[model samples]
Target: MADVDQVRPRQAASPSMTARQRLALGLLLSAGFTLAVDFSILNVALPGIGADVGLPLDGLQWVATAFALCAAGFTLLFGRLADMFGRRRLFLAGMALLGVASAAGGLATSPAALVGARAAQGLATAAVTPAALALLTTSFPEGPHRDRALGLNGALMAAGFTAGAILGGVLTDLLSWRWAFFVNVPVAAAVVAIAPAVLAPDRLGRRPRLDVPGAVTVTAGLLAVVYGLTAAGDTSWGDPRTVAALAAGGVLLAAFWVIESQVAAPLVPVTVLRRPGVRWGNVAGLTAFATETSLVFLLTLYLQKVLGYSPLVAGLSFTVLGAGTVLGGIAGPKVIGRIGGRSAMVAGFAVQAAATLTLVRLGPEPSWTALLLVATFAGGVANLVAIVGFMVTATSGLPDREQGLATGLATMSQQVGITMGIPIMSAVVTARVHGLGGQGPGAVLGGITTAIVVNAAVCAAMAIVAAVFPRREALTQVPPAAPPGT
Candidate 1:
């Protein structure tokens, strides 16, 4: 990838956007927030849904897995479709589908029905998310304005995930788990109702042939990989079924690369992945997302199981993190404006690494008043900064035609990191506890601390990687075009 100093600098005289453009950006950000919320909203609702629908634990796990499989699997396909057809049309369709799916999930009477509804929600998210991102990147010219917009987008996305954890628990306790899914209905309806008026229509471009084989292979591969990873959490990673699924997924993905090399219009062109910025930025994004999420997952367990806090109280404690995330989001653009994307990203990673290291002080009798709260808040802020910086760098130099692919790759990296992180980290915690050889509080604390130390090491490694990345000056410099296609 090009280093920060290598890209052409933005012209001193940057043009301003109209009021309609600002409104369009707001609508798109709202869409992003809802989709992010939907990703995690069902997590806390799992136990309740399982009881109501008479699902065993294995079946219950699939309730969340089903959504992830479809969402992560189909995102590239929908991203390409948006490029072929129209982003606005796809966005509206996705919103409609999500509204319907949310309602179905809310009213589901059987496990099959709920799982199917969750899958539908995932498919809808695949469409809605990439379209919204592509639209935003194309709508705003790349400069300080786009940087600020993306900062808010990254903020809302992180905020939504954090908020969902708390909101899901609240809704499940006060009303019903069903209300968690139901909550998206009105939000989707509002966005769908207003989108047409605020967003500009895409002009007809030469549509490419849909790469069906590539899409099928990739989708199947992702499904298998996600299933394997999810299974590894419950059963041993050495389990035959888990091993088989992972191997199959690898084969399919290898086959997908072969198909892409020969196809007329590949779903994800190999050339796109070859870009240094895109490749490294996604690597940074995946690392940041995985480490941050793993930290949160371990924190929740420590608070509830080890420290004897209620689920609701543990969830509410994240408010400090949430506050820091929002503030960090607001500050990210300014940081980028000063230091540039690469430097900002490296700094973010460094901050988060330091924050994670602080949590190594965690003990059997925790000090929530000082150490825990400070580390949590710092991690949140650093996470948002890294996220925004990685996103900005990844998609920085791409043209409008490739915006969908760029955003799709960025989003996919995040999903894959999250889907894989928890299981892997949980396994680490489990092995550590087993080695320590006791169920006592001290042993439990040792295990949690060990897992966090691993997370800290990962963060530190990513920071080193980010620091060593070659400068790509093209990322900071804005193109002269005022509109997307020009």
Candidate 2:
């Protein structure tokens, strides 16, 4: 196997995006949007799905967990496959699989069938996300153009989640819960059809051998960890299932590390982790996702349980937060260009910390105009700004060959953060609520306040970490574009 860290020639800066590049970007962004939409679109429709399929509450929960677990577990493995085989090939296959899985999910009549379809969807997503992102980073030269593209990508993804939430409710009411799953079918088909014509062809290269042991161990470990975390949400951390899963995961991961160090062609080169950009960028991304997702959960609870808002009303209230994120995505690239990614990241985190702190002021009385909207909106903006910065930072200065690995690592951090955040905060809030007597508005508010305070402290600490760490050079700078026609 060829060494992944071999130095390559750097390309001179390109002037602007060609028409083909633009089309390819559109297809990539569509894939991202579809994936993000799928994640949240089922949230409001879960009850309806459970009813139609005769699923119990626990079975209904698996509808979401199956997707998250598979996606988180297989992302790194698929990412490495993309790098070794072909990113474009992997991307097209993923899209096709997603379409097929979505169709199956929509047609399902039983709980097992629907859950199986969801797991397939998650696997497809794991393949598509890293491959699409890797294609983007490689195709777009790392600079203003790439930054702009990433900003739009971030914005659309955030918008997709928000749109899914509202659209899921509407579709479930107007038609059926199945419509939420059916929606992605057409989108995926369109991308698959158009992508071949528009996107650049994958370059033919020597096929590097896979690190089978590393692949098996890491995938198993991640699945175990994600399963344990998900289980912790429903039961206590001390539950036997959770404890066993976590312990197994820890052992597997440790074994994976040992195997990677001894292997000649490791799945992930240790040097990649040594790079300050990749290391701190992932840290920032994980922190940002964890805190922001927790904030959303807390706010949702506050809006419904405390303020007595209808689910629809609470969902609508978040439209402002979505709007704020879009605006931040539009501005994030420009801000990074002006101040650099590290500085932009630190600033975004600092602002996010402040915004989260302000949420502690929320109370039993509705504060839509005064505190709630402003804080949520600010939190959304800061969150995206931080997210965009993290992506730019992580992908920067890496050669095109390793883009898949870099993106996979970054995306895995995001999935893990999103998976873990709600559970951790739930545990905290449960403890605090019980301490203060129990489930009343005042107790819930106090519990939420405690969680928000912890979230704010985490943001603040990460900001300091980003600021204090000196940026290190990548293993190798991004290589120049391949000569035309090989």
Q: Give the residue spans of candidate 1 off by over 4 A.
A: 9-17, 470-486
Measured by TM-score, the strongest candidate is 1
1-486: candidate 1 lDDT, tens digit per residue: 444533744525456767998899889989888888887777777888899988887788888888888888788778888888988899999999999999999999998899999999999988988889889888877888778788899888888877888898899999999999899899899999999899998885888888999999988998888888888876768888889989999999999999999998999889878666788889988887788777778888888778888777877888888887888888898888887777778889889989989888887575653688898889888888888888888888778898988988888787777778888888888888899998777777788889898998888888788777534423433457688675
TM-scores of the candidates in the order shown: 0.94, 0.93
Alpha carbon lDDT at 390, candidate 2 = 89
Q: How many residue pairs clash in each candidate?
A: 15, 1
- Residue pairs whose backbone atoms clash in candidate 2: 11-480
RMSD of 2: 5.6
The TM-score of candidate 2 is 0.93
